[model samples]
Target: MQKAVQLEVYGRVQGVGFRWMTKLVADKLGIKGTVANQADGSVKIIAIGESATLQQFIGAVKASPSPSGHVTKLIQTELADVSLCRKFSVVG
Candidate 1:
């Protein structure tokens, strides 16, 4: 089953090429979503894909794709009313 999730990733995520890493991971996973830097020093990701794929995406993200980035916390919320993007991107 397909699903969507809004992820709030905290810690040394901004200015560490986290967004680009996220896009690479998402695209590789065939997930459609958006990754943007939040003002609160967090990275927000909206991911849409198969249930299993989403889980993998989350794990990959948590593993810190960006070598310079550190994820102190990751909060995921299931989203039911989101517009799926055609591909993963690094949005503002």
Candidate 2:
């Protein structure tokens, strides 16, 4: 089933290519949502798609970026953005 998940990755996440790399993951997973840099030095990622795929993408985030990213935390929540769709993007 399709679902939406919002992830907030903190700690040196803003300046890196986090959003673009996340877009790559979402695109590969056939998911939809947006990723952006917040003012609080964090990256906000939102994705909607099959639960399994979403989980896989999350795992990717932890694994691939784990080496360079000192992720202090990864928080996931349900996306309530009604305007969300099936194409991932990088929001300013």
Candidate 3:
């Protein structure tokens, strides 16, 4: 089933190529939506795709691209549908 997940990834996430890493995973999983840096020094992602795909993407986030940007937390929730995304983007 399709699921929409809102993720808040913490730990030295900003200015660390986090969004690009997220985009790589999302694109590889065929997921779509957006990823960006929050003012609180975390990364936020709104990803929509199959439930299985979402899980896989999350796994990658936990493993982050940089060793320093450890994923301290991940918050996820389901949206009603995937009718809003055009493509995965790194929005400010």
Candidate 4:
């Protein structure tokens, strides 16, 4: 089944390569969505893909942090409407 989720990653996520790394992970996982730095110093990710793939992608994101980034918390919320993104991207 296809699924979409909104994730808020907290702690030392901004100012690092978090968004870029996330995009790379998403691409590798064949997921589509956007990753951006939030004003509150969090990294926001909206990903759409297979349910199992999404779970793996999320785990990868949490486990693999950027060299300068540290993930302290991850909050995930399921989205009812998938964005049907064509590709993963790093957005500002």
Top model number, TM-score: 1
Q: In model 2, which regions exceed 4 Å deviation?
A: 64-67, 80-83
| Ten contiguous residues minimizing lDDT sum, candidate 3 | 65-74
Extract clashing residue pairs from model 4.
none
Quote the RMSD, in angstroms, for model 4: 1.1
- Tens-digit lDDT track of model 2 for 1-92: 77888888877676667677778877888878888888888888888888798889888776545345566788888876535775888889
> Which model scores highest in lDDT?
1
Write one digit per residue (lDDT tens) for candidate 3, span 60-83.
888885655677787777777677
Give the alpha carbon lDDT tens digit for every residue of 7-79 in model 1.
9999999999999999999988899989999989999999999999999999999988899999999999999
Pairs that collide in candidate 2 are none
Q: What is the lDDT of residue 57 in candidate 2?
A: 89
RMSD (Å) per prediction: 1.0, 2.1, 1.3, 1.1
lDDT of each: 0.92, 0.78, 0.84, 0.87
How far is 22's C-alpha from truth in model 2 (Å)?
Answer: 0.9
Top-down TM-score ranking = 1, 4, 3, 2
Clashing pairs in 3: none
Q: Please identify model 4 stretches exceeding 4 Å from their true place.
A: none
Query: Each model's TM-score, in the order given?
Result: 0.95, 0.85, 0.90, 0.93
Which sequence of candidate numbers ranks them by lDDT, best first?
1, 4, 3, 2
- Clashing residue pairs in all predictions, respectively, total 0, 0, 0, 0
Assess the local accuracy of residue 86 in candidate 3 as a C-alpha lDDT between 0 and 100: 76
